[model samples]
Target: MRALRAGTRTLDLNRRIAVMAIVNRTPDSFYDRGATYALDAAVAAGTAAFDAGADLVDVGGVKFAPGPPVPVEEECARVIPVVEALAPHGLVSVDTFHPEVAVAAMAAGAAVINDTTGLHDPRMADVVAAGNAALVIAHSLAAPRTQHPLPHYDDVVADVLAFLRDRVALATAHGVPEDRIIVDPGHDLNKNTRQTLELTRRLGEFQELDLPLLVALSNKDFIGETLDRERGDRLPGSLAAAAWCVAHGARLVRVHNVRETVDAMRMIEAIEGWREPVYELHNTRPEGND
Candidate 1:
């Protein structure tokens, strides 16, 4: 995968997995349950997460599930401050389908625009290209913040691959540079546990697109139901899934637990030899020692 740049910060994602910490600013978000709804709280959480070793902080002002519609101004008001505050710390990606909100966030120092709708909106790619920001095109069943119940896919993996290929081409046609684009197989977004699992099992298929593949499987229903664990107790499952994705082909992981994900991924990298060990003392034979 090519390197991804978000504003002044860039992620050299070669033979390495990058972690993005999720910062939800909505009061009714599924996870966190409004813990960081307040501006100060959100900023603090993002800052702390970055310090904990997150490569980027994905700031989302509205809940992903169906809820009250948030105005563009409201969304901007919710996330811009956090993005500006976290700019110097590391890369900041704004999760929004609204072109207006994406533009505003980029103006405030965001480097990546993670539109969960997969560029369903015609204007989103234009905004990303115009801003010269990176775009994360995620595959969603339909428009984000809407309902698509009882979803059906003939072949979940095949469908996801085709959708991503078409969308990535569309983004390039819209003038969004190829290197600045990323693809995500939206887990549990209008998909049931079975479909999500199948997608995960064949996750490497997404590498066919030849772009960075990002998966947001942290504490989602698929993992929880599969393991019969609650959200608070799903870290182990989440980490396992993340490690599996990295081993398979996925290059980026989005999650809430920044510190744990960082340590787990570092260990995976160390074991795989994709990253150098910090101390290099384990199981090493010193020169002339034997």
Candidate 2:
């Protein structure tokens, strides 16, 4: 797969996993509600994420869990300022399925559109294509504000792979290049605990698509349920899940705790045999001494 370049940083799929920090600019995000709602707070969060070694920052306006919906105009208003604030820093991704928000975010200099609804909105592909930005196609079986009650799959891995393949084809048919697409299984979106766990365990199956896979299991409800902890206490479980995902072929991890995730990624890379390349060899002795 070709590397997707966002400003000075190029995300090589063959290299170690890339970390995408989550910066929710909404007032009701499940994890970080109101943490980054203000423009100044959002900027500070973005800077802190970058300083902590995030390869990208995902900014979201509308919280997509089981909650009341915000109008598209309102969502656009909430996301655009953060996108503008983070533009010059590189690799800012807007997390929304609304076409208007996606367009506005791109206009504000976001490099990627992370649509958790998997392009269910007809105008989404066009907006993303118009901006020539990367798109994260995350699979959710239901609408943006609802959860999938009693979700079932004949074979979760195969179904996810097929769904993502079709979504990629749809985007490509709409003029979005294949290289600019990434796939996510939509970890907690519309999925029950068992389904989410199974998807995480079988993440490697989706690699057959050959596009960059982004696993976003950070601080989600499933982790909390499994670990028997609150949202704030699920950091260790989140890090563990991220490491497992990276080992299983995920190229990018969307995380809430940027610093901890960065440290965990470094540890995973070291265990996976990552080593610095030797670029120079010094010779102290004279050239003809031997």
- Count of backbone clashes, every candidate in sequence: 1, 0
Query: How much is 170 displaced in model 1, in angstroms?
Result: 1.4
Cα error, residue 152 of model 1, in Å, equals 0.2
- Measured against the true structure, the TM-scores of the candidates, in listed sequence, are 0.95, 0.91
lDDT per residue as tens, model 2, 1-290:
57875433567767667899999888777887687888789889998999899989999988777778898889888888888877887689999988888878877888889999999986899878877679999988888788778888998888888889899989988888777889999897878888899999998888788889999999999999998999889999998898888888888999989998888887777667774533434554577433
Rate residue 19 of model 2 by lDDT. 90
What local lDDT score does residue 51 receive in model 2, on the 0 to 100 scale? 88
lDDT of each: 0.88, 0.85
In model 1, what lDDT does residue 100 have?
94
Most accurate candidate by lDDT: 1
lDDT of the structure predicted as candidate 1: 0.88
Q: Looking at candidate 1, what is the lDDT of residue 52?
A: 92
Q: List the residue pairs that clash in candidate 2.
A: none
After superposing candidate 1 on the true structure, give the runs of residues whose Cα lies further than 4 Å from its correct spot.
Answer: 280-290
Clashing pairs in 1: 6-111
